[model samples]
Target: MVNENLATQVSRILSKHRLKINDRTLKRFLTALESINDVLTPELIEILVLDNLTIGESYFFRDRKVYNFLRKILPSKSDWTVLSIGCSRGEEVYSFSMVAKEVGANFEITGLDVSPQRIEEAKVGCYKFWSVRFLDENELESFFNKVGDKFCVKSDYRTNVTFTAGNFLSTSFDKKFDIIFARRVLLYVENEGLAIKKMYDLLQDEGLLVLGLGEYFPQVLEIFEPIAECPCVYRKIQRKEIATTAYKNVSEIRKTADFTAKPRAENANVKDESKKLKAQKEVITKTLERELNLEPALRVVEHCLENKKLIEAENFLRKLVHNFPTHYLVWKYLGILEMEKGNVRIAKEYLKKAAFLNHLDDEIWQLLRLTKGNG
Candidate 1:
């Protein structure tokens, strides 16, 4: 029989890592944890539990579009400082190094993740073929040397990119980044508003905050302004500017507001100003809900990703792509999945379809870069 007390303790620990497990999953999870290390030291328990529970998926050159866009907008002559939050195994940081070199821009990139094992792997700078499948043949030849079955990163790429392991919420940085890549991270955070505010504080003035496609929260508007041309890009602005934008948004809502409130029966022609105003408010609320309502299918995919359930995640994305036909984001994520799986040919086909449907997504554009060359 499973000890209820032990099970509760495990649940509390995983909760700190932003996981909420049901009683059944908890039982199965504890079984596996015990099988790995029955001694169950506090540190070991935390690590084992989180390793199985946290949200993490990564690859070299995973999102090609984001880098391509950065290359164009960032000053090539400046010394660029970039940060990748929740950088699992450091593919994102390494990708930026390659981008800087290709763009002929001097740069420093820091990758931060909470898993110590991931940090250790990143420090080793060696990866299985699966982790770097997105890099074309030329990139693979240029950046890595095969040892047995794994590839080790060359010295040039490893020199400036540093990996740190810690809770990002409690960590401190000495300097702000010119750009921060926060893709696919917020969905796993318990207090997303606080996490986002911290990201804003970590940016240089007017620095860019890149989020996952279709990821937005009301709190984001309080600290940043969306770049109109980029689907997931937001730029930090002064508080005054945020206030002005908020005011304009309210005014625009009012202008578009309409009502069917019953007026005085004797003077039905005259509108009840208060009821009309309430109706306008209702309309605004409904519109906001419609806009932020993430597709249920996509949420399922995120949940699968969080748990490292690749098959489920892939299946969900494939189904969404089939059902919606032109749902570009699903196509984009599906392509990312294939790239991670080392299927470059199929990945390119899916990514190209995504780009054709939604050209502005920086995520899709970046991955397309690899298909051009095998070496």
Candidate 2:
């Protein structure tokens, strides 16, 4: 059952944030609201509800194919401006940073999300082990530093990366971007046309727009053309002129790669079979890791917290802390859980432990300060 007054209030709040909530999500939102303690302020309730609605699961180098495509097409240019839409916890943004560094491109990236809490987490630039499961030892060493079982993005990667909390449709930027990554975001947007218009306006002429697999916008094909050898990637089509030498190369590559007719078949069945076996092996390994990893347990705790199931969230956090003693996030969340329960002393103690583990976390320190005031 849904409370009509509360449902209307939630709708009003979401509308003010430029977010459209459908009936299904609104129902779930109301159910989560039922677990809220009356001690919470209206502002805290708003942040909690909005944050839950915007939460997403993500990790670095999520799609290997997309990163490989980006590697090939990233022009050798200076001062490239990139925007990552719905950059949940900053993994994608840092992944792009590593790509730009490898390609020797001078680039700055901005990550935007509707959740202020997620934006704060992105600024921290620390991640759990599961987030870097795809990276090998060498890649880890190159891009991150280990701090008490947590991996922090290196100083080089963090230098030019910035994060903002706002709705993209309502937010205005002073400058346009060369590349925009809006993967799987349109699926949730209520007005697809308005969202597309916002993206179109924010992108420079002939800029790149990268989308997730299976996402398509045929109506806007006149403004954006799919690039060759790149899946789900489109280029803004305004002027019919090549902007740079690298872009000219892209055009040339597309022209030469199209042979309209089949070429002579080569007898390489054995080699192809071996490649298929290797790919299968990789998929199986990823599956096994997904099941065996503790990251999913953390996500479960997050889900519990989002639903305001404090006791359930606390139980999971305790188990996680026992198994992963050095994982500061577990401690941090425990602190937050206590704070939400109005136990300022316990919250401060838990937060102190978290802060000691990762001294660089500004959010933890801020939380500690808040707990002190509450105490």
Candidate 3:
């Protein structure tokens, strides 16, 4: 028997969050709701129990291929750290610990969930016999000891696992780990881009990042190269630095290398050198123009200012303002750069143009005061 109103509400919530809830699961949830209502008061139900209902179902070795890959790659005796994000009720963490033990690996397993109540329940290390319905009867019997009717996790295996409460929205980093298991968590997040970026920052260099089977984001894959494809897991690709040499210096080096060449080819070489130099100058000019062409190029200007390259950046800004005189933000940025170099007079002129274009920016008032003081 299902409560139609409750079922519809639950369905609506699931749909709002972009989660697919089958009719069967909705019916089961309705039955659970009825059972809870029978025991608990309405106020308590409204306050706590209803919002914290666990929807994700799991089993021992849920993805056999992923487990197999883990078993194959992981060393037998080494210090390894694994983070299981959105781990509900400790089942996945326990399963990981069991697998690590079987593989004879020395490891630390951490389970994180947003629900404090679920974390407390997970800390107890007890579960109902039918909770692991996906496991074989023999396997369940072997892993659990009879504590009345409920199956409790063995004590020896329970010591290595720890549970913590965490939220993905906060940008906090405590320690980097070797492997982060974020399976089935991304589907629930509002902004998948930020979540993927956060996960990238959390993982250490050469660390493995595992995701669920159906979960796929192209932007994530573009940033992180796929190492193991079948299980659809990806590892962060180590960024490589591009080698840069000054064009003039490269030409000089080439000339030195070919110093003893014949006279007839010397003319051709000189012409080539002239063409290369012209091309190099053109490139440099274009780059400078592009760097200055941005409106309110705060990031670029900041970098240049830090490196004591304000003159170069200013030169670019001057050309940029000449090309686009109406760009108020660029004028303001140019004013800031000029102020940085102690050119108060020139800075005042740029500030006036910026203020005339857009008088709303408050910082221009301060700049005007500073310029007047300098005068």
Candidate 4:
């Protein structure tokens, strides 16, 4: 029963936070909003709606490969500044603190999320069983102290971590960070391009931008390049070098131009040229189709995986591999799928192929080692 007025209000509220949801979900939320007490103020309604919509699903060390890579590359001598965008309940920021301590690196990490309740919970530094489910006995004992039935973060780990509840797109920072961990965050943003540009601006020259696995966007390449060892990690391009590179590219293009070439012979040669153009057009069309299909196909595979439809996910992944043989993601997911199915040896092979495609992909290497251990 959502009318135009309610829809407009919902749109305005979501825009204030730069968030987006499918139309069905929006309508559901509006319907729920209508049933609420009429005595509530507009501000209270906004807060309640946003809190319900906020996604705070996270656990400690959710992606081990990402943290392991961070530990491997972080220099001990430098004082690092890290930012965790969409850091649900602060696990990620604290994980970085633990890594910094292990590597003897001086660091300060900031965790930013849009949910005030989440921020308050994060500041408390207490977690329930589900949040710490992945931690081993040693890690749990070292990082947390059991209080009653809950585990609380040790003071040592909490010293340099700060949590703030603010929308990333609207919040301003006085300083740029050396690393920004924004995994799975941009997917929720309505204006993803603008969000990316904001991250680019807030990142120092050569700063790291860490994303969730399989999260790819074409616009990111304009300002960042994927690190050799981590396909999900990108390094910001230096501003001055961009100008120089553009000038060099323009010069090279001018030098390579052959605009002064004489006209070709007629008839057969013209037909031959037309045939060549048609062949080239076919190639371009195929390539374009693959490019367009890649994201949707991956989403379907992810949906299958989430639903534990391993066989179906594998079928789609196999097709993706056949179509995009050189794509590292195809091989990576194939390896992951095989591992999920308990085919350790087959997983190893797929991971090895992925490593060959992106030799520096740390996650691939990590998965390969994991396969070896499981085998």
Residues 141-171, model 3: lDDT tens digits? 6676767656688876787799986555553
In candidate 4, list every pair of residues with a backbone clash.
229-360
Expressed as tens digits, the lDDT of each residue in 1-375 for candidate 4 is 565666676688888888988877777777887776475566776776667776677778766667888888887348888999999799888888988888888998999988888899999989886577556567888989888768899999998899999999999999999999998888888898998889999998889899875576656755676665556677898888556443122223344333336243433343443454344335434544544455558668878888889999989998888888877668888888988888889888889888886654456777888977654
In order, what lDDT does every prediction score? 0.71, 0.74, 0.65, 0.77
TM-score, candidate number 4: 0.66
By lDDT, the better pick of 1 and 2 is 2
Whose lDDT is higher: candidate 3's or candidate 4's? Answer: 4
Lowest-sum lDDT 10-residue window in model 3: 241-250
Candidate 3 off by > 4 Å: 1-54, 241-375
The regions of model 2 sitting more than 4 angstroms off are 239-375
Highest lDDT model number: 4
Q: Please provide TM-scores, in order, for all candidate models, with all chains considered together.
A: 0.65, 0.63, 0.51, 0.66
Model 1 residue 111 lDDT score: 91
List residue ranges in candidate 1 displaced over 4 A: 15-28, 34-37, 247-375
CA lDDT, candidate 4, residue 175: 95
